[model samples]
Target: MEEESGLSDVLPRDLASLFSDTYTEESHYQFCGQQLRITQLYGARLGVAAPVWDAALNLCSFFEEQKLNFKGKKIIELGAGTGIVGILLSLLGGDVTLTDLPHTLPQIEKNVSANILAGCPPNVCALSWGFDQVNFPQDYDFVIGADIVYLKETYDLLLCTLQHLCGPSTTMFLSSKMRAEHGTVDFFQHVLPKHFNVDLQWRNVEDNINIYKVTQFQN
Candidate 1:
């Protein structure tokens, strides 16, 4: 994970493909120009949060490119499975809140506790999509989600959750690998625009991942 002679730690597009693989147990990554070490505590369950995936890595790289000094900016990561993105942002200076289902909290908290030693450690909370009132703070400068739009039934709920968390100016970063055959991408496209203005920020052709930057278009 050597920097190829640049200020940013982002790997070149050609070299990023080398990292695409299913992480089984403990693994280390050079994320956003820093060493990100992660491990899987439990077995790989069907619905449970697992280890790092390609979309997560792409989101990390996208954050680096944005160059928004995260320090003191309140951020929220929806469906924060491994909490990798939120943890990395916290390390970089963001005050992050990592939210997921109740069952997913243990693993996410474990990752957050292990990785975030200084600065603002991310707050791990249990959150279900489409709640009228969430337990955690609602206002955030940015909301991030990675590989979260995979399920067919949860599309609207995901949008609702984002709507609830975001302020009028909150910018959201969502990364997902296309699953057109499963209607994942189409459903997301249909629902997302109703809430925010969606723009394709970057695409990783090698990994088939799309990172989108979303901003609220209405009050």
Candidate 2:
């Protein structure tokens, strides 16, 4: 299927066919020469419909291009709303931990189990931004997140969590849609830079999402 600039621009007929009353859909995709399946739970009040967000799509493609070696590496995705990013990494040989709110774990687990082999399937755990401290092995080589910066209230907590998860060698890949609301970029402008060495990696104009590759700066 050809990529559309954004979901808002879905054609009338296409829109009807794209959605389901069941609020769940199976998406088939190929990444790095491997066939993968993603089961997405949509229309949930608790942010389950994030799989279609442009940021997610952009990050998926961005990783395919970069093809950073994930084999035998420890990777974790914060706010793994649909578990797509981590699932992809796991498919590429990374030991992945997909973390999200408790309510969202089932969907993440389903996607992971369906795609990853049984023995070493990606770990699906509950992680509340700024609230829960999960006891997973630390020093994650890569921390990934998408569209996780929507709320200003969670900015400090998110940063603190990232600081805890990221060591000097760890790299964080974040994709956020730029909101038109005033001060939407305030986190990027004021908070993120104060903590990490941030670099803009990619921007998808259709969805207005900016992808940043960041690493923690030593104090």
Candidate 3:
């Protein structure tokens, strides 16, 4: 999720301002040997789901760097702001679902439509963490998220949603920028460990971004 001041009413004003660029109407990214032109609504009242974030870019780079094949895999991205990560994976041949709150779907849909180069275009849906998770299947091969764990209030809801979506064999890739104010480090180190096995897959030290590989904790 992109940083926003109003998201939970806890994000600091200055921190939100750092990621919210009002002048950037679109963002271009190159991944999977393809260029992606993503439409962004940065200044819109859409809160945190409008613009692209560094965590999303780093996650895409991590996938490409690891040569992870998404061919024919069933994947879903939670809090898919701007739909950049899912769009890139879809281009790599994954059947990707990009989901966020109802009000945020239009922007994600627009980005998905604008970047449908080949293979199946990613599906866009409204999924409010724990609330509508039942509407989605739990058989996904992969569950992915970018910068979605910032709000401490949403921890349980996010955990509930993750439990519903991840099967025993499913793997999750969550990329987050460590923000002391937002308690992002606590979410990865303490909260998620109780139910999921979390491993640090990659770290962009300069950017303070960490990509974690997660899976259900089997008894």
- Tens-digit lDDT track for model 3 on 1-219? 533444645446775674445654877889879689999776546667776889999999999899998999999999998999999999888999999887778888888888995557888888887789999998999999998878777878899999999999899999998987777898899888988899999999999999999998788
**TM-scores of the candidates in the order shown:** 0.83, 0.84, 0.91
Summarize candidate 1's per-residue lDDT along 162-197 as a digit string, tens digits.
777778868888898777765657855876877689
Candidate 1 weakest ten by summed lDDT? 1-10
lDDT over C-alpha atoms for residue 155 of model 2: 68
Q: Which tens-of-lDDT digit does each residue in 80-132 have in candidate 2? A: 87788888888888989888877778888888888877558888887776667
* Regions of candidate 3 where Cα sits further than 4 Å from its true position: 2-24
Clashing pairs for model 2 are: none
State in Å the error of residue 208, model 1: 1.3
Q: Each candidate's lDDT (Cα)? A: 0.73, 0.74, 0.85
Model 3 / residue 129 / CA error / Å: 0.9
Estimate the lDDT of model 2: 0.74
What ranges in model 1 sit over 4 Å off? 1-24, 42-48
Judging by TM-score, tell me the better candidate of 1 and 2: 2
Compared to the true structure, candidate 1 yields what TM-score? 0.83
Top TM-score hit: 3
How many Å off is the CA of 211 in candidate 3?
A: 0.6
**Any idea how many clashes model 1 has?**
1
